[model samples]
Target: MANSPQSKKRARQLVRRTTVNKARRSRIRTYLRKVEEAIASGDKNAASAALQAAQPELMRGVTKGVMHKNTAARKMSRLSARVKAIA
Candidate 1:
């Protein structure tokens, strides 16, 4: 479908970017899952630690254009609240 050379190059770049983005998204989900597991275990300390670890990853997703700034902020807010509630 990409008849033009520029279009073909763009298609190739898109494929590479898609893989990278998928990896980034998966990594973020793994971090979030860790926090969820920590919270589920009812360990406030562990949940706090997990949330701390996930915060940067979530923000990094925002910076990398994998997620929106507000979306990341909202997720962080809700996760921190849940972490705080794990008493």
Candidate 2:
């Protein structure tokens, strides 16, 4: 229960932020899933393209505070390596 006006305002802000963050997270996951599907289909070129497209999205998630910097970096590194190995 938000008794104070400030607390009520904060709760409202939190709800808004949560919705935005959820959308961002879902968008990032969609990008990652595209990359994964491309990889699974054994198409190196498609996988590379998907990875390239996803890289910025993942980085955007980091910048937006949806994900950690190192977490994004590690994901990019592993995905790129997998894409490279597709050949």
Candidate 3:
């Protein structure tokens, strides 16, 4: 019920932002899933590579406001540790 023109415009902008954010979130999840699958497969080299590839994507999510910086850092830390443990 956006009666005011400004409110209507804001609602439209919100829809657009939501679409973009959803895509960014989905892309970030895909990268994280790749790392997880690589780690689960017990391939050290592949997991390391996947982790390297995912690092920037996760950071991008933080910079884009799709995820919190500390959340991304925590995930990266835990994932890297798990990757390291996969001997």
Candidate 4:
């Protein structure tokens, strides 16, 4: 119940921001899923390429405030390790 005009405006803005953030989060998840699929296929080359493609997207999520920097770094580390293991 946003009685104040300012509160109503804020609520509207929150809806818009939520939509944008949701899209960003979904995009990042899609990138991560690509890397996971490439890794699961056991093709080192493909996995490496997928990881490379996903790295920037993940970092972009961090920069956009959709995700944390440390979280992105941890994901990159684990994915790269798995990619390396896909020999």
lDDT of 1 at 72: 95
For model 4 the local lDDT of residue 32 reads 92
Say which prediction, candidate 2 or candidate 4, comes out ahead on lDDT. 2
Query: Mind sharing the TM-score for model 1?
Result: 0.98
Ten-residue region with minimum lDDT total, candidate 3: 24-33
Clashing pairs in 1: none
The residue-by-residue lDDT of candidate 4 on 4-85, one tens digit each, is 9999999999999999999999998998999999989898888899898999999999999999999999999999999988
* Candidate 2 weakest lDDT stretch, 10 residues: 78-87
Model 2: CA > 4 A from native: none
Q: Who is ahead in TM-score, 3 or 4? A: 3
Clashing pairs in 2: none
> Where does model 3 exceed 4 Å of error?
none
Model 3: what TM-score?
Answer: 0.98
Q: Global CA lDDT of candidate 1, please? A: 0.95
Q: Local distance difference test, per candidate?
A: 0.95, 0.97, 0.97, 0.93
Per-prediction TM-score to the true structure, in the order listed: 0.98, 0.98, 0.98, 0.95
Q: After superposition, how far is residue 33 of candidate 2 from its true place, in Å?
A: 0.3
lDDT of model number 4: 0.93
Candidate 3 residue-wise lDDT, 1-87, digit = tens: 999999999999999999999999999999999999999899999999999999999999999999999999999999999999997
**Candidates ranked by lDDT, best first?**
2, 3, 1, 4
How does candidate 3 score on lDDT?
0.97
